[model samples]
Target chain A: MKAVLGTMGDEVKVFGFWASPFSRRVELALRFKGVPYEYIEEDILGNKSPLLLHYNPVHKKIPVFLHNGKPIAESLVILEYIDDTWKSNPILPHDPYDRAMARFWANFIDDKCFPAFMKAVMGPENEREKAVEEAGDCLKTLESALNGKRFFGGDAIGMVDIAANFIGFWVRIIQEIAGVELLSADKLPALFKWTDEFVSCSVVKESLPPQDKISAAFKARIDQAQTNTRP
Target chain B: MKAVLGTMGDEVKVFGFWASPFSRRVELALRFKGVPYEYIEEDILGNKSPLLLHYNPVHKKIPVFLHNGKPIAESLVILEYIDDTWKSNPILPHDPYDRAMARFWANFIDDKCFPAFMKAVMGPENEREKAVEEAGDCLKTLESALNGKRFFGGDAIGMVDIAANFIGFWVRIIQEIAGVELLSADKLPALFKWTDEFVSCSVVKESLPPQDKISAAFKARIDQAQTNTRP
Candidate 1:
């Protein structure tokens, strides 16, 4: 496998939590681009690493990519940076409209869908019903957006596909943890098929943390939430 | 006023809601780029215009930019399209890292900042405090993100700047309508200065909706919310 080099130097570092979908998105992007980077795992809920804080002082969030000494925060931003700095495999299309479409869906995932998904994952039983309804709306929109394309960008995994991958992979895991199914295959055949194809991609398959590990981590998180809420 | 023209013989049309910050962002981008497009206002809350539904079938949301009859949904996507399809004024940087940085802040505005701002605007009286606190945190991070740059894109009023312009303008109006001040100059000096500079820009100043109109609209919205809750 060819390693992608950073613009500043040979050393690249990523600060991320183990089970975060955002962190996974960046990891997949790096692996797809063949970028060689050292991963530093952080305890997101308990304590953040000093390096993580220093690197991303503004947001202080995980998935901070450090190329040489300069730090870039936000998974979507880092994906674009990785694609731009290393040109081995382009993650976005060359055409501006195509790029915009990719970004639009990516933003949609971050802005609208993720929130609804989170609500379903972490909410009271009564609120969970509403959350599921919202998630269903989001999934329907995503299903329609896929519209016969093998991938969101068609024939290739691009930025939007990377951004929306969480809905495919993590949503099921989250459902397993939450004990409810959010995405039904019958309702979203294309998205489900795309999910299968997406994980089968050599880069994605290799980079993904084990599903059992993810499920365990998610279960622990829910347990913690429940414990905290107990009177 | 010079009308901003798209490609030769292409009819440019914008499907937008009157008071949406997302729609306003697109309008600002078009006006700044000097692109001429026919504006079709959609009654999004009651009856979504047929053009809006036709143009954006996937999400079916407003601020859909139709250039030569091809529809592009999402404000940031439309902004990118306007910047790319027209070359009169560039909204993003030529350098990829800089462009990524601009996008980072733009995504910051869309994902983090705007949601908090909206929550503060529409949330209940008790929830407003927490929402305001979150909005303040976002603004503080944004202040640090600026880091002495004249605009979010260094010297240029780029895409990120356009994306964040609502925080400078509508936020203040909403704060007034809600009887709360979320952004104080003392708390976020740099952000406040940037807000002033942003609103004072020639195109921005010219294109902004009248303050009285916005205030009245907000008042009506508040009344509607109250009426919906009445027994």
Candidate 2:
């Protein structure tokens, strides 16, 4: 059961939804690390796929990473596992301090940025402004952390960049649907530029979903939300 | 620059708050790894120490780990860094799958169990029952994951065990203050027994806060919560 350079015997599979940023995290990790994985798009908004359900019984969320018949749930946790299993192109930094910092910021995005963004996009009309402000604060911290670097991981796209893929593409798409601009040149100049640079990277550009498709899906979701809330 | 065994050159320090389970995570990690560190308690409720703020400007939380004057924030991230830096007593399993599983559950405790437990304890009166039910569901997942194993890491205490430290001591104290039972023998027998075994482990026992003091602190917090909610 030894892992030879390119061959790890285990069949790699990813059960994911097209528009989910969590799914995109795993996709980018696999692609960046040069690991071969079959991607299965799950029907998340409708009937839950049995494979996803079986693989992820507890959370039952998309982006369930299955390596050699073993399923690993949670996007960040799965990303780390991918980095560990595939050592050819290391996703995390070698230095322990730098690695810890990368993980800290990634966890911040997962626990802070993503949630605040969702609240801003999906929250009630009366609360959207406050949520947008909170989300802006989260993004501001991220912008400051970049510290004039091109990527969160300086000079290259690394773990923190992969963790922040949502900011690069999904945030704008969400903003388009919600008709609220959270990431602007004036408020977040560095982050605004970071997003453009991040999404344009060859690896990221190849993996990104079709912009029109995602935009349409988000528009439908917003319409559904409005319909559910009508007086 | 090089970290020699038992003598990692740089001064190790842990900025923590008493009665904070997150703080205990770092203390237990340093103790278990046999790493020498100076513990500096922070006043989390009152004015936070300047050192804590300086080290961790983002969250401004306690248990900011300092190794050779460099700060690493977030307890889970710190735990991983400690394990990575210290090669002698490895905190995480070497097997990639096992390590991923450990990280997954540790994250579950942080992202799911603790939050649900807080909601159940601190949620408004009418929502208490639903919150309690949700918290119970979270505990049920933890119990099933344990599946008669002595510890989450099989025999020895590891990262998952450290993450679940709150369940061993703090949850009961919070339950005592809230007057609600979430981890009773009837409800979570495996977890109930697991907590007993977890707290008795020498490293965990030594690092745990004094029961009476933590209980008093919880009482004070509960009283403050009640006062804030009064019309």
What lDDT tens digits, residue by residue, belong to model 1 across residues B33-94?
Answer: 76677888899989987767887876789889887767789888788778777877789887
What local lDDT score does residue B71 receive in model 2, on the 0 to 100 scale? 96
lDDT of 1: 0.81
The per-prediction i-RMS, to one decimal, reads 1.8, 0.6
Residue-level lDDT of model 1, residues A1-231, one tens digit each, is: 123335334677888887788988888888887777889999888899888888877678999988777789999888888877788678888877788888888988887799888777776655767988888888888888888989997898888888987876888777878877767678788878888888888888887789999888888877776566545
CAPRI tier for the interface of model 1:
medium
The ten-residue window of minimal lDDT in model 2 chain B covers: B1-10
TM-score of 1: 0.88
Cα lDDT for residue A90, candidate 1: 85
- Fnat of every candidate, listed in order: 0.88, 1.00
> Compared with the true structure, what per-residue lDDT tens digits does model 2 show for residues A1-231?
233643455588999988888899999988887778899989998888988899999998888998878899999899899888787677899988899999999999988898888878876767778988999899999999999999998988998999998899988887978888889889899999999999989999999999999999888887777566545
Tens-digit lDDT track for model 2 on B136-230? 89989999999889999888888998889999889877898889888988988999999999998888888888899988988887777656654
How does model 2 score on DockQ? 0.92
